[model samples]
Target chain A: MDLAPPIRFELRRGAVTAIPLAIAVGLFGVSFGVLSASTGGMGALPAIVMSATTFAGSAQFAAASVLAGGGGPVTAILAALLLNARYLPIGVSVARFMLGGRVARFVQSQLVVDESWAIASRGGGEFDPHRLVGAGVVLWCAWVAGTVIGVLGGEALGDPAALGLDAAFPALFLALLVPQLGGRRARAAAALGAGIAVVLVPFTPAGVPIIAAAGAAVIGLVRR
Target chain B: MSESWAIVLAVGAGTMAIKAAGPVLLGSRPLPAQVQRVVALLAPALLAALVATAALASGQQLVIDARLLGLAAAAVALALRAPVLLVGAIAAAAAAVARLAGLG
Candidate 1:
């Protein structure tokens, strides 16, 4: 079905606003592509296919790293799923805004990523679904395109970490976090979450630290 | 299918299910007031955790490496109110320079 003019305008504006972040994410996609193709036991086709289908960066990287370390399929899949556990809460947060039939809602849900979600957020628990969908589309395209380039380039891409693309994830996350640090409760949660993650990093599995940190948000339950 | 294909398809399927679970299950239900408050704080908490893990840890170990330089540079850029893209670029450049200087 066709989008209404107002929604279409919002979508376009979202796409435009997301372009810069998309470029950064695309470069990170290139790193994933190279890693999967080179040592993750996934060839060019499967790597690209995974990127297109899964559309989750940290989870994909975790799975590929597991495989690269000679872990089995079950291990890789589990690691990826654990890394993605955050999506459950993320989905809940935005569910009401996701209007449409089941099929459309599912399709829109596919577009939700950390970057797009952050971009779509209006403080105080609000969101713009059109912006989320729009940004997701652009970022998805860039991710897949970057994967194609990386997998095809393969060995020639050398060490992606050397290019500092790995740094982009943290950088991007920091930028996203700063904007949301507006209130005392938010700041407290942020500090608690970061502390939990930092302390757990040395003791937990790949995805555990991040997941454990989400518990810090339970502080929101206390009256300010 | 090859093991790689199997893993890829399985992970894809699993992640799709995970992503869809919320919108599918909740389906426009009105969340409780407390739940809404928690949801509002979720993004900041998650993003902060992401920053900590992505910048400071590699695997199960905390590695104080060049990624820290990148993150610090990003902090400075963000403080100066740089756009997100420039913040990322500044970060990558800082990490790359650190690596070139034999830091990581």
Candidate 2:
């Protein structure tokens, strides 16, 4: 973890936008918490702790589906691995900026996410790994907070939950995704993954098949 | 212990391992620039792919639906280089209206 003194100074100077970012992350977390319940999550404790520790919202959602459906460990692991393979690149990209030793890089790796990637990739400035740790911790907490509410308060959703409120996530993720569209290969791969997932959803578990489709698309890209 | 937690634990462990690979492997050696550029684009590309997967669904053997409509609307907005937020709202609105009209 990044030390308190310097990261605190950075926070005081307003170089970090932890609060807004955490709230934004909180929305996603709430949805996932509701999702955990919808997917038959164990209890608030397990659900919240899962969100806090894993810190990958999509993977957590996907995992919920897998566990709900009585999927095997291999299926869960493979699905999580595929869903999170995107992080491999995030790790590599952030690796470019670290001036610290092995321990620092290791910690920074766990904290890498959409916001951290944005912060790190914006430029090579004075934002240290400490700040990144602080942001990750906040983001993780926001997600956990949302999970707690979602699990405990989930029964309150009633009709909205029944009406497929989970669709909101795919919609939200899609919105976050549209702007970055570029190049033929990338377009092709995206199309392939979506196509396969849509086609395969009925035959397989809800989120699992989609992730499998993503793996297939990634393989195709790797080959190309 | 929820089964979901099991999956999360597995993912957390997997993510940490993937995150540690490059830095630990290189050990103070700067990576090739070409590799860096490629790595930079990987997350965005995968995000786009996952986004597309999230948006569309296949019903009764690839019938057209609101998702396709939303996708097309999103495409037009995108071609005009609309802001990301606007494009998403426009496309989603178009799709939602169509679905609400019982067209999905």
Candidate 3:
């Protein structure tokens, strides 16, 4: 592995690599903010705080949806937590890259998410610690900034669904999933997961199907 | 605090704990080979599941709607190797246009 680049250089590279996805992330954040704000009980401030603190788009959106559907706070939190359980494996993958002391590791762990994890682990077996930190910083800022914009303009934005922003969530995931479909095994695992989730959709709660689908990864353990 | 705020705070704390678990517990030790392989596959598998659930299901019901058009547009854009941002834009536009046409 090459010597770690200077923090500034890594930060710049991370920001640049993340810029395109950040726009989509920003849009998602804006939609989440608008949805949370419009969901009756949640106000703009709570929405902003949730985005700032949680920093997990899908989890937050799931929680908000639960709340909107008349679920209690405990139920909403549980749903969000279940949705976020993916971060455990993600954190394990990025743990080696989280350099420095225990405090630094703890603080940096907060940046673990789908995009940052994907970017940092893009090198396959080797991990880029700088990219991890840099991407986390840029993506975090975009998420929070987008939420602020959404909260302020949420009413004006009026119905993110009508704008097709709701579809953008799956669209973004699809875009990310495309590049990973390179190998036959990966494609099979993905197909199995999707098939299971689709089959369970009508019977499951919002986030449960995804967790259940994680079982499909067990196929990776099987020899061809 | 208000109920919403409390929920946010609780969720936030729970999330931070979940995020912290791997780094704190695993430290520098490598995962077992089989575990690592499965972990590697988790992202693609979970992401595929998320895409299916998000695109095909609304709440608890499965329904095909404008989102399908949007997903198709995204697929076409991705196949053409458009920039990631452009893919999203194309999908959104396709879905919005479809909705306007009462296809949603």
Candidate 4:
């Protein structure tokens, strides 16, 4: 099938749909950049490069916090790796939509961040590859741009907390989640997941709680 | 400094590998039915988990603070079917005002 026009439409829709998320992600990136500059021993180039390459905010934040606290490099990297392990399942879930040849698959896989994944998965069973890629590109650009701005204006940006941008991340996620809670099963799964995460927050490492919460989806599978 | 750089490089490489693992291993094969159902549910589950943690916790402990109020405002905005950007803006504004009022 000729997938061009549909892909194009989805791409445009995805980019437009992602603007808010891109903005929130940009703010988060700015916070990371400022923190990296101040305490992570990361200069502007390294900070930009990390944001561009890793493109994962929580992992970057974890690594930066560890480094700032004088933790060893190995320890920081390990923490980041553990935090990022959640991507493995996300990648698997999105793999089918990563259409095309080996090269295309490899290239598209790099765009698999949380926002893109969430947007792409919202298509109810029909995963849209174009939407995923389009959202990924916009988010990547926003994140990189935000990091550059933050690094250059590190001191001027001050603490993102003061501006209350720290709340933006959760706000965006909650917004995305509300629309998905339409069905009883979905609501149950989400409630279970939230409960698991809240209970584990004080016990587990930072990212582990979320990954563990992903297990709550088994309720959906069991009910099916 | 070099150690920091090395750590960054290692993390970059490690994260890339993790991101690539699913596509590399799973390929284009359709997931099994039960797995597919679970995968379908993963987004809502993981996202809710993230929201709970992000809004309520700071470091190791859960805090009742401006962030909670901001989240509540954002929830109201979302329930009203406001645009995603507006929801985030409302949340941020609510938190900022609450903080200014020494709420947190």
- Fnat for the candidates in order: 0.84, 0.30, 0.75, 0.75
lDDT of 1 by residue, A153-215 (tens): 877768868888889879989988887999999999999999999999888889989898889
Which candidate leads the pack in TM-score? 1
iRMS values in order, in angstroms?
1.0, 5.6, 1.6, 1.2
> How would you encode candidate 4's per-residue C-alpha lDDT over B15-52 as one tens digit per residue?
99899888877799998888887877788898899999
Clash totals in order: 0, 0, 0, 0
Model 4: DockQ score: 0.78
Write one digit per residue (lDDT tens) for candidate 4, span A1-224.
46678788999888888889999999888888888888655666788899989988899888888888888888788888888888988898888878877778877888989888878765444467888988999999999999888888889867788798988778999988887786777888899999999999899877888889989888866744
Candidate 4 ranges with C-alpha deviation above 4 Å: A1-3, A123-125
Query: Per-residue CA lDDT of candidate 2, range B6-85, in tens?
Result: 66577777877876776555655555755544453444445554555555543214355666667677667766876544
Candidate 3's iRMSD: 1.6
The residue-level lDDT of candidate 3 at A148 comes to 89
Q: Candidate 2 vs candidate 4: which has greater lDDT?
A: 4
- Taken over the whole model, the C-alpha lDDT of each candidate is 0.90, 0.58, 0.82, 0.85
Docking class of 1: high
Q: Candidate 1 regions off by >4 Å?
A: none
DockQ of candidate model 3: 0.73
Docking class of 3: medium
The DockQ leader among the candidates is 1
